[model samples]
Target: MISGILAYRNIQNSILNGVKIPHSTSQPLIFGENGKYYLAVFVFFFSREDIEKGLVERPTMWAVADIETGKIIEIRQTKNKEFSDASYKIKYNVRADAQYDTSKKYYEKAFAILDSCRNEIINTDRFNPEEYKHYLDMIVANIPKEYQRFYFDLSV
Candidate 1:
């Protein structure tokens, strides 16, 4: 069985390789469906130069990946009109910002797909909380202190 931490790393690497651009990813949220694990994360695209200048652009997108294979199943811009409808319009530039708004839908289409598949939010049977915490700590250590706050919340 794949551990949640391993799945998270695999998916993260897959996304990084696939994007081929400077970006930052939110903490992955893992779920299971049809006996297979999956993960969803928000990605903020920006240039490496922006980091040195302390000006990270905030164009956000979201992706879902198959944990076992680390293949991205779907990825879409959060501001894409194709995914937005009258009932679910894009009002926030960031997924984290949408999380607090009770009036608007956040990742409505992606969540619908998962819901259709009967996806169950999970942390995986083999998840080791202690190890995962250590992993996160290591990751945070490399990030500048001013930017470290973004890694703390995994609600998305």
Candidate 2:
């Protein structure tokens, strides 16, 4: 419960910090794995400097990993069109002006959780909805009945 909220709050911070959270507002990030429920929130993309410094470059996707089950799913794909200069400018404006209310501690905690679960996320260069759905179906089928309601809300 606590960690889930923390993750959401951290993503909210990213939005306020001039970065898109990368998911929709109509849903609560949801997953069931290893007998647990996880709510994911997308963090920001690496800056040009950070990219040049070898931290990260050319990030065009997002992820929400199930820490317990070691299943990390890329939540969305940002096509070149989706992030074109014009679109980026729009998102950037929103992010820059958005108010961030989460605390420092929340960001740290969310980072820790994501880092710990990093290994679970299988890397790929592109975002394919069909492929994501195959994985999503597999994971969804494995979730216990009690969590079905949550998944229903999260399904696109």
The candidate that achieves the highest TM-score relative to the unseen native structure? 1
TM-score of each: 0.45, 0.27
Give me the displacement of residue 4 in model 1, in angstroms. Answer: 10
Residue 149 Cα positional deviation in candidate 1, in Å, after optimal superposition: 3.5
Q: Over all chains combined, what TM-score does candidate 2 have?
A: 0.27
RMSD of 2: 14.6
Q: Note the Cα lDDT for every prediction shown.
A: 0.49, 0.38
lDDT assessment of candidate 1: 0.49
Question: Considering every candidate listed, which one attains the maximal lDDT?
Answer: 1
Q: What are the per-residue Cα lDDT tens digits for candidate 1 across 1-156?
A: 344445556667876667577777765554344554566666666655655555554435667776444467977675772211212222222223212322224333333333323222343335444444554454444455544444454322
How far out, in Å, is residue 51 in model 1? 3.6
Q: What is the Cα root-mean-square deviation between model 1 and the actual structure?
A: 12.1
